[model samples]
Target: MSVSGVREAAAIWARAKARRDRDPEPATVEATAPGIRRRLDLPGAKLLLAERGGRPVGFALVAPRARTLELFYLAVDPDAWGSGVGSRLLQDVEQHAREVGREVLELWVINDNERAIGVYERAGWVGTDEVERDPASGRLERRFLRHIG
Candidate 1:
């Protein structure tokens, strides 16, 4: 992804997060650039962007772990929710994971995000009862995993 692409991704991320919380801080290019650069430089990192009508509508960033693909970030433009953008992005992630020899797909979702939780569950992801704090936002997060081969 290009720097501009990361900026777009950051905007989507911020919009999605803010929809779940009041007055959430926005993610700027400066805030997301370093991580984008770092991930692009990583050997096992996969970044996928979903576009419609030639405009980006969603993105997913996954990194390879020992036996799993960690979905570090996934976001769809708020206006595109419920339009299958999230599902297509996730399916792309799973395909990438399989191509890379990962056996499982894992991600953390903020506990109070019922919409996201429902989407994940409907996609066959199972909650693991593992809770953790998201350092950046101090939100409680639940772990979800799916065996993807």
Candidate 2:
């Protein structure tokens, strides 16, 4: 993904988070763009984008960690919710993990984000009892794993 693509993904992330969480004050692209770019710069990190009609609708970022792939981010534009864009991006994430020789994919999702948790569950991710407080948002997050081997 290029710089422009990072920006687009950032916008989608902000919008989706705001809508999903019903945040009165939503984060802007400026707050997220730099972080997305930084993740893309990480060694072995892969950015997967789902586009429709030649426009980006969703994106996922994954990086290799030991024998597993850590999913750093996954977001779909609010306008595209319920349209299978997130599911398609998730399938690509799994394919990328396999291409990189990883057998497991892991991610952390906010504990109260039921919609996202449902999506991950439907995609074969199993949640663990482990939980952590996200320092940035102070929200509890739970770990989920998918074994693709």
TM-score of each: 0.89, 0.96
Best by TM-score: 2
- In candidate 2, position 81 carries an lDDT of 94
Stretches of candidate 2 above 4 Å error? none
* Per-residue lDDT of candidate 1, residues 37-134 (tens digit): 67666668877888899888888888998878998888887788899998888888888888988879999999998988888888889999899998
For each candidate, what is the lDDT? 0.82, 0.91
Best by the lDDT measure: 2
Q: Count the backbone clashes (under 3 Å) in each candidate.
A: 0, 0
Please give, for residues 15-89, the per-residue lDDT of candidate 2 as tens digits: 898998788866888998988988888889888888999999999998899878999999999889999998988
Please give the lDDT score at residue 105 for candidate 2: 94
